[model samples]
Target: MGRYNFKLPDVGEGSAEAELVGWQVEPGDTIVEDQPVVEVMTDKASVEIPSPAAGTVVSVVGAPGEMLAVGSVVLVLEVDGPGNAGDEAAPSVVQPQPETPPAAEPPAGTERTGAPAGEGNYVFKLPDVGEGSAEAELVGWQVEPGDTIVEDQPVVEVMTDKASVEIPSPATGTVVWVKGAPGEMLAVGSDILILQVAGPGNMTAAPVSSEGPSEAPSPAAVAPARATVVPAETPERRAASPATKPGFATRTPGEKPVASPAVRRRAWEHGVQLQFVPGSGPGGRITQDDLDAYVESGGALGTGAPTGRQPKTGTEDVKVIGLRRTIAKRMQDAKRRIPHFSYVEEVDVTDLEALRVTLNAQYAKDRGKLTLLPFLAKAMVRTLPDYPQINARFHDDDGFVRRYDGVHLGIATQTPTGLVVPVVHHAEALTLWECGAEVARLAAAAREGKASRDELSGSTITITSLGALGGLATTPVINYPEVAIVGVNKMIERPVVRGGQIVVRKIMNLSSSFDHRVVDGWDAAEFVQRIRALLETPATLFVED
Candidate 1:
């Protein structure tokens, strides 16, 4: 049996490194070709890395939850071929290129030579995949060693923090070498693969070289065609002063710009030259605001005077990371995409509360004791038939709205993992007892992080509550794609006119929001009125279908 060092193949574009989410197979397990062996997660996707050739798992290289660079070795396998009997070492790494200073100006009279059609060796460099993306995880390779590929053929998948992208072959050639295995993170514009082009007769193009001398000039190796001033390393200049050297305004030769990594990332994202962006920092260091102002004003880099913005104090840096990060994105998307109209209506739930208390006294063995939430959910489902817009989803770009026949009620629960909404499917068909039980079950599962993917998604409409901790009103952001959300406020006893007499009534606010794009003010107001009507009469809620 041949020992194969199965490197983790590049899975998708911009994937420099991936978090190993799970493993389908363990060491000593037999696996077949195309069988899923492991699952890796990038910010964009959770992808299953499949086996290329059927083999036995000799070793597993990465642990679950470990972040692995693209092209890193993730497994060792024994292949069936007799030739595989030979021992193979780990995947080879591309030799690091020597850092070169950015030149101020190119030598005059250097003519441009486009892509070569003729034969010879060409080292294909990994091109810049996305803005601000300096490195990416190699997802998988499309061609193997010795495979003949044509120009523009898809070559590999890369995963960036933003998205996954497919890279295409630069020229039609024989694949002689492949670089990096899946899950290995590679820098942009680094040597990734090598190709042997058939030498063309009467060739007009130069052979792309991986090295100097006999090798043809590689375009990637050439510095940017821009005038640059490399600071001279003079004795007088060296001893003169540290501030005199172009440390801030000008970048150090062969060194990265003098800015924080975040500032540098911002510059990259905006396609702004860090050197061109005049720094307003100490000793003229580039700052994030400088880059932002520069890009905002059409490359007017230095014109942005500092606003009265003060640096934050007494603030600890809490990164928006992991599940919390994802929640932020969704909440932001919902608020940004949906034009929400908030409506707060007072509902006298004194009767409803009484009914709940009476029922829970006997509900000791059934539905785990009903609460106001179940009653609210039932009231919503009952009122949805007359006002279906409240129980629907809206796709703005498609201009299509889906009003569901079934109430897949989403219960927004705050958990240790963050705010999670788990769906109770067919909530309309469920009895009051079922709704309460389902809410209890879903809430427990969500809080424990054991809710299934389906349970956490596809919610038609949602209900959020703070229970006893609820305030007078809350304008909750609509859960994305869904048009409405019901927020329950705390019940307060206040003086009210009951039958023309001053009396204390248990009143609560049903603070809710609706997407104005799909739900009109009239429709929204009328819908809440229906809920208020049913909720006020308490008995009407149970009598309705």
Candidate 2:
């Protein structure tokens, strides 16, 4: 028997590692070529790794939940000779080889200089754009199936960890098919679109007079023209440039602008005309900061006015798929397998807000600004010692609870694609400034869809805040394997009794959900109350240490 080692290929774009979500076949199982052998969960999406060569599964290198680096030997297979195994009837599996066609004799109308007559057809596969990005979201399609497309025409828009990028057509041709729909995730090297050239109609149109002397056309006889014939713009190319129509104002001759899709969307939502804004970015590109400054200065469109209208309502039936789908499955599993309890409390943050303003200005340059998240993260780290149960994870098989001494705070951030929680390792050890910087970095990466697999995994506890959503309070679902999660609500001005008279104070709500089987309700409530007290009396956080 011949042994074939099938290592884990680079599944996602630029992904270095992947978590083993599941194994389809175990040792000694007979598997066919192209059969899925394992399911791997990368930061981008969960993908099933198929067998490259047909063989019997000899052994698996790792267990579920263990991370495997790219190119690592995931499994070994023992196979009989090619003809004796399941691959017997399969077509020859040979490595790709480039073929050069035989040179054609000089035609009557053209000279044969050995250069290929027409551009060779190329198959455009999905490209890996981000680290650990396995699949990409099909956001939009510029060229439809069966439409004649030109080379470099934007064929589709795919969302990766970097941003939504437009995949251009490789060669001019009629698009034969599109493999996936909008919002669908396509794996790397997958054939996204197929094209058929308009040139070769049939083999019957050959040389009518093959017997005649193969004489090349005379240079003097060839008519020389000042202008060249440009191919007619196909429908696909026309569709790409919406501003190319008549009467549309063309951009002034200058450097081109650069802005992300999200930034452009935000500009559209604010009803700001981008053409009028004096961009400060490189090459005169409008940036998010420029947009913000324009809005602050009341410079152009919708200045000093309310934002644009709400988006049109539409019922979206999105299948639980991709990273969001995995998150849902894990959450459901956590709720079913682990007993959970929640605790809620309201806190006055009047003094905390004042302190935040002072510290923000004090460390303005080094540490952008001090947000409530870092302060709360610090408070949680300090209060965990009092209620260790809240920091413990339940190990049902062993009938023992696993408690952690240091806090790995998972900060949840929402992106255009879905929700991602990037962990801040050893939160207790980080200073307030360091914690703030980490939070800023992680949140920005999460929002921009650039968080790595390690950054999004292995958290002891989680914190989710929807202060931007303007909700009073919410019980956040606990991110599984970990025992508890804390939620932060909007800070609003409310009437409060100060000594004897009514006073206005800024109050915020805090809520927590814990594994009841591991942590008692009393411990959960006490832990939340401790965090609330720190926020209410901001001085206590600094004084207690």
Note the clash tally of each candidate.
44, 5
lDDT of 2 by residue, 1-545 (tens): 76676778886546676655567888889999999988775555456779988888767775443456787666777887632334332212211111212223323332212213552223456765444678887654555544677765556766654344555565677654455555567887655554555443111112334454233221222223101111123222222234232222224422123444444445433544444456665445566778788656654322133478868664433334445565677778888887777777888889999999999888878767888999999888989988877776677777887888988899988876468789999998998889999999988877755576678777889999987684886877888778899999888999999999999999888877888877887778778888888877777787755
TM-score for each candidate, following the candidate numbering:
0.51, 0.52
Q: List where candidate 1 sits over 4 angstroms from the true fold.
A: 1-18, 21-61, 67-314
Off by over 4 Å in 2: 1-321, 365-368, 395-400
* Per-residue accuracy of model 1 over 1-545 as CA lDDT, tens digit each: 77776667775544566665557887789999899988765443356778887888877765443455677677778787752435656433322122222222212221125435545555666776544568887645655566688765666656554444556676777765566655568887666665667763122343333344232223333334111111222221122223222333344322223443334334433334454567676446566667776666555233344689877553222334445667889999998899998999999988888888999888757547888888888888888888887788998788899888889999999975468898999998888888899999999887654575567779999999998989999999999999999899999999999899999999999899999988899998888898898888889987844
* TM-score of candidate 2 relative to the true fold: 0.52
Which candidate has the highest lDDT of all?
1
Give the total clashing residue pairs for model 1: 44
lDDT of each: 0.67, 0.64
